[model samples]
Every structure is written in C-alpha cells, then in structure tokens.
Target: MPSSAMPASRTDLDQQPPAAITAAGLRKSYGDKTVLDGIDLHIPAGSVFALLGPNGAGKTTAVKILSTLVSADGGTARVAGHDLAADPQSVRAAIGVTGQFSAVDGLITGEENMLLMADLHHLPRREGRRVAAELLERFDLADAATKPASTYSGGMKRRLDIAMTLVGTPSIIFLDEPTTGLDPRSRQNMWQIVRELVAGGTTVFLTTQYLEEADELADRVAVLNDGRIAAHGTAEELKRLVPGGHVRLRFTDPTAYRSAASALRDVTRHDEALALQLPSDGSQRDLRAVLDRLDAAGVEADELTVHTPDLDDVFFALTGGTTVPHQAEEASR
Candidate 1:
C-alpha cells in the first residue's frame, strides 16, 4: 500500500479520553490448551472497540476474563479504573455483559427480566422499577413488557437483554457476539443501539462474527488469531494493511480502450470488457497519477472506479482465510 493510503498517526493521545479498559500480558488457558497468549488491549472511554477472530480464538474468553466472569491464568487488567484482580466487585459494579445467548428468563415477562437485573444491582425497589420502566421504553420493549419473554422475537429478546444490562447504568459494557443469529433488519437495529450507547458516553467492548458490524461500529478493531492478537488498529488502517487495491477504467469505444491500455504501463487488461485495471492504493495521489497518464495519452475512459479492500479482505488476509462462520459460532453458543 502507498504511504498516502496509510492511516494518520494518532499522536494527540493527551487529547483523547482516559481508557475505559486496559490489559497487558493477558494470558489464559485450559490445561494443555492455551486460550489467550499474552494479549494486550487499551480501549478509550466513550468509544466502541471490537474484537474479531475465528472460532476457538478466545474472543469470548477475553470477554469473560475482563467482565469478571472468568479468571485469567496470567495477566493484568483494569476495567472502569478498577483492577481486575484486586477489586472484581468494583469492576462488576462499573460494567455489564450480554453474552451470545439471551439471559432473559423465558418464564417471566420482559419487565420482570429488567426488574431482576435492577435487583441484582441492589437498587432501591422504587428506583429499580423506575429504571426498569424507562429502559423498557427506550429499547422499545415497553409494549411487550407484559408478555412472557418466550413469546418475544429474536430481536425483541436481544433488545431486552441489552436493556437489562443497562439497569445498573454501567459505564462499560461487553457484548460478545450480541447479534449472532439475528435477521438482517434486527442486526441493523442492534448496530443502531450500539451507536446510541456510545453517544451517551458508554464505552462498548464488542466481539462479533460479523465483519461489517466491526467495520460499522468500532473506532478501533483487533484481530485475534490462534490465541494471539495478530493486528490492532482502526478499520481503515487495517484495510490498508492488505494489498489488491486498484483503479479501473472502462471504455465503451474499442479504439479508446486500446489506446489507453497501450499507453498505461503495468495494467491488467480485460479485452472482452474493454477495461484496464492499474495497481493502486486508492489514494487521491494514486488516482491523480492514473488520470494524468490518461490525459497525457489523450484518451478518455467512459467509466472510472477505485476498488479498495474492505474489512472482509483485511480479515481474510490477517487470519489466513479462517474467517468467522456466524452459524458455527451461534451453534457453539
């Protein structure tokens, strides 16, 4: 990739928010099998940080350890400014977690589920009810508050699960594959909810099988592969790490196409389509260079398009094509 396509340096760390979560040398294992091997992370407050990996790559294990659900074999972590090992209670108080599966009680109404979470947080009865009611409305579950959770759709149940997570007003939340099995519309709805959470100054730590989810919501993304962090950066930065970006020119006239193709050096020609593809990083400078060459050649292409790598391309490259299978992850849950 060209230097012009690279992400700008984030040198203004002093102007950024304090980290909502931080970890170093985070190691975990089950007997002979290592789950996490010295992974490190630093997520700023009021931003979304996404973790992506293939099955058994320890994405959920990382979440469990940080959320105080499981202990790390060797590591140090802090959440909401509380040390994970020394003050787990404080960390629990400051954070909430919604795993891949819904934690809602199918036997009870959605309102009951919210109230249950409020009680676990030890809120006053009156205040618990107030927060429960408010959250139910906010998540658009108020109308279904009186119905049993078993009757709710997958999307509604997911919304309820998140609403319950907010009952305690946690400053940080961990969502591990939160939208794994939802329909397209439901998935988009969940994305919107994540946006709303970040807008309200809540730092989100997300793990999802959907690459697009991370691409859409994450301020920064990390790829975990084989119990290690392979790469970590903003979406665009990671995308730029992969090659195969190019600028394509298509011409309707055979004469113009031949002239342009002959003038342009090192281009992949599509004879049937009358198109030429030039290697590029999709940067403005690269585009300008291609256009300059075309202008000098005195040939005008009918169409010009820039093709750059997306998250899918980045994920495949970093993981050696071991992309997360959403259905497989969902089944494991």
Candidate 2:
C-alpha cells in the first residue's frame, strides 16, 4: 500500500488525532434484557473503528447510543466534542447514521430522496439541489436519478442510501451493517467508499457481523460479546491473541520426513502426506529456528508454509465458537 493510503498506527501516541467519540461505562437495557453492560470506547478522528459481534451482541445498540438515537441507562459519552446527554442536537448535527436496513424510500426518485435528506439538514433550496446533484454523480447515480428507488437493484439502493447520508457533510458517520445484504462485488465497492470517506478525514463507526469486512476496513476493531467488549485492538493485535499458529514442512522423500519428524522437539505428524507441523508463532525468528533444526538434521523439505491465525480464529476463540454470519445467510435474512 502507498504511504498516503496507509492508516495511522495505533502506537503513534504523539500523532494521534483527537477523539471523535468517547464513552465510559456505557450501559443500556431493554425490559429484562441488558443490551450493553458497561462498554468504554475512544475512537480517533479520521479513523475507521469497527464493532463486531454475533447476532444480538449489542453492536447496534452501541451505535444507537453513540449516534444519539437512543439513550443509555448509565455512563456518559461525548460525540464530536459534545456531550451525548446534554447536547444531543449538536451530536446529531455532527453525525450521520445508516442502519442495517436500507433507508431508501422506494416510492420516491433517487434524486428526490437526496433532496429530502438535504431538506432534513436544512440546506437552502439551491444548495440542496447542488449537493444532491454532485452526490448523485459522485456515487454514479446520475443516470438513474430520475428513476424511482424501488426500480434500482440491491447495489444501487445501497449506493443511494450512502449518498443520502453524505448530504449533511457529517464529520462522523455510524454505519450499522451497511453491506449486510450486498453481493461480493457490491461489498467491495462499499469498502472503497468507506476508504474514501476516511481518507477525506471522516470518522466512521461501523458495526458488522462480517469478520472479513472488519479485517479489511477497520483501523481498530472491538469484538463485542454478550453485552460487553470481549477484545479491542488492531486486527493483527487481536489475531495474536489466538494460539493456532504453525509451520508446515512437506518432504518428497520419506527418509527426509522421518529424520525431520525425529529431530523436531514437538510436531504433529502426517505420515501419509509426509508432512510435519511444528508449533510456531509464524515470526521470522521462529522460522529461522525451524530452518536451523532442519539443517542440523541433514534433511531438506520440499515445501514449507507458514500458517498464522486469522480473524476467524480470533473470533471463534474470543466468542467461544460463535460463528459470524456468512453473506449468504445474511442475504437470506
């Protein structure tokens, strides 16, 4: 990746942007169920922060509270430098929200939908038209602007939905599973849109059940489980928390394989395949150690591959095997 497109490092404390959103001990409950027990967050400006979880894990609830659409039972939060409780109007003014479901009005033309959002933000008539026109073209909706939203495909509707959200020019946006029902190609397009938003200095708070989406887009990720934060860090940091990393060595000669299997201190053997799996963190040092051991044994492997735990491994380990819903499953819903 180019340096310009690289995300700011979390460890660069001195260069950290001001907090776009901050909450401490935030709690919420609906009737007998506690949606959020006590969650704390500090998201930096111009960064993409993703909240991930299984179904009913309070990801949406967290977005709702931070966006000022719902009130928290306890704790305090500040969004866009305004207290969520004492200055909700200001918070609303500085932010935009796109929920899990499409908010596009099928009865109205796409242009009309954009105009409606412009009106909601209280832009002047002429300015509203200009903004709407510009955004329509930006999202490649110009040709379909006059058509009713209902006539558009799933991808077009999603694009229009985001275009409407940008009408207010909000510095912060809360996206609650924005790509849930999108096809793979459409999802990639949406990811590009998110990248552009952050590149232009917008802070995005995203919630999703798609682990790969979080891994791809988020500068920092927080995994929510059972109404609390299970883990929060960069994708790499979270992956390191899981312990299934290893190095695999395959040999064409059975004799070489046996020599390696005997020389290695601890290995999982695959006798039929003539392979040995050695425990490793997949670091360069670990790899070097394994190579040294192979040299000592006077054995050479035909193929060597490093295997490191990914987000799926981290998610399963952190959430106790609760699987993230796949795209097919989400589309069915």
Candidate 3:
C-alpha cells in the first residue's frame, strides 16, 4: 500500500493495447450449441472489468477461452501481450485465475496451498517460500496457515483461494463468480481485495451473477445475453440508459402537497401518501431547478427522494426475462 512502492511501468498500463485483455469476433460452440456467438471484449490493464450474465449466457465459456483452459473455435484473443492460441504458454505465464468454485485442496494446510501455487509458477524454492509467507500474511491467513484448508471458514477458504491465485504475481487475473455463495460480509471482503489488486496495477476480469457487485466494483461492465453483449458501459452510464427516473416530494400537510402538485402540472400524484412524483433525468441541476420552482411558489416538501431505474430495469428491458434461466444455471454451478 506504500505510494512510493508503486511500479514505474504502471503508468503505461492504462493506455496500451492489446490491452490487458482483448477479444475480437470471438466465437465458440459445443457440438451444434453455440456457446459464444461472435463476442468482443477490450479490458485495459489495471482496471476492473465485470462480465455479467445469467447462467448459460456464455460467461464461463468466455472466461475459459480467454484463460486458455478451453480453445476458442474461432476469433482472436490476447492476454497480457500474448496471443492465446499461438503463445498459450506466455499467456499462462502472465495471468492467474480463480474459478467459480474453491480450488483449494482441502487436505492441505493453507500455507501448503500458497506454496503449491508458487511451485506451479516455477519460482525458486527460497523465493517461493518468501512469496507464500508474504501472501499468507497479506490475506490474513497467517494464523491458520498451518491448519488444513478444510478447517477454514467459508470466507477464510475464499481468501486463501484468491491468495493462491496471486502467488505468481500475475498482472492480469480472471475471477469467475469469485464471490458466489459467499455471505454479504465475505463478498465485501473480496471486493476490497479486488480494489487493492487493481490499485497495484493488476487488471481484473470479473464475471458475477450479482448485478450490484458489478455496479459497485467495475470501472466498466458488459452485460452478456445469449452469448452476445446486450450492453456495455460504466455503471452510471448503464443506469442512465433506463427510463422512469424521477424525484419524489412529500409534504407535511395536504395543503402543502396540493400547492406543490398544482404548481408542477405534469407531476404524478400519490394523494394517500401526501407525495408527488415529478419526472426527472436524475441530474443535480434538474433537482435544484425543481426545488427552486417549489420555493418560488411558497411551497416546500418535507421530505424528498430520488428514484432511478437500476440494472434490474436495464436487464429486463434488454433481454426480457432470459436472465432467470441463466441465474438458475449459475446457482447450479
């Protein structure tokens, strides 16, 4: 976390391409079933990019193809400056992956798992020991380092899983539904770790079923539907794409409510609740203007609330209810 410890080369991590990851016209199929139909992705280094979709939406398929665990039937992909097909070894060397399930070997101690990952990375014995120790400490697994992974709590196991993924010092990582099944507190812990990784110049490719997770963590997000990108943008940008955004104003008395509703002719009334809803783009200027109008009319709302369409609205609007089937599949996974 030391500012001076930052790498000098990290400054260029943002502007370069093939980027940390790049996929163009990527296609995949199993037998006659098309898993990925000409998908495209571009994730800059040192940024968190969330790939969101319900089950069978090709989220895992895309992750596998990019991670070199499965070959793409068509198209091109580059990971950390290496072409996935032609130089898979190089790609393997440059990135790490934590899949949807816990890959931690239950029989082994937490420290052993970290050391195992170091060995896979082909680090020297002395260096591997150093890295394992450092990672165990960093992930707060030091106390349980000597305990079998099976003895770790759900959250502890998850921390160890991610810690193992970092043993190789990968600059780019793929986290497939990394927080799946974790409790809220554990999920938040994982989010903090992800932020720390990106802050240290590690690009994160995250796939998750939780819409709010993506909204909270991703610098940019792409919602995949039926193996194709339905939409992609920053969280706020995606939110803005959905309509029905409004501002609600509540008055203490019926008189005040009537005055405000009459002053705003186009407002929708909720007479029983003593509230009125005015259509708004959900912008600060619009809010100020609305309040100014009420003030000039000698009216004031006792309480105010802003409502904007969230990702749920965006998902339903774009893909109908197909995400339900997809989520069912993820839960199974």
| Best by the lDDT measure | 1
lDDT of 1 by residue, 57-175 (tens): 99999999999999999989999999999999999999999999889999999999998988888899999999999999999999999999999999999999999999989999999
Residue-level lDDT of model 2, residues 1-333, one tens digit each, is 677545555357658689999999999999999999999899999999999888999998999999888899999999999999999999999999999899999999999999999998899999999999999999999999999999998889999999999999999999999998899999999999999999999999999888999999999988888898887888876765667788999999999999999989789999999999988877688899999989998989999998878888877876886443232122111
Candidate 1: regions farther than 4 A off: 1-11, 252-259, 271-273, 295-302, 321-333
Report, for every candidate in turn, its global Cα lDDT versus the true structure: 0.90, 0.89, 0.86
Off by over 4 Å in 2: 1-12, 251-263, 271-274, 283-285, 288-303, 321-333
In angstroms, the error of model 2 at 149 is: 1.0
Residue 173 miss distance in model 2 (angstroms): 1.1
Q: Write the per-residue lDDT of candidate 3 for residues 203-232, one digit (tens) a residue.
A: 999999898889889988888888788778
Worst 10 residues of 2 by lDDT: 324-333
RMSD to the hidden true structure, all candidates:
6.6, 7.2, 7.6
For model 3, give the 10-residue run with minimal summed lDDT: 324-333
Candidate 1 clashing pairs, residues 3+ apart or interchain: none
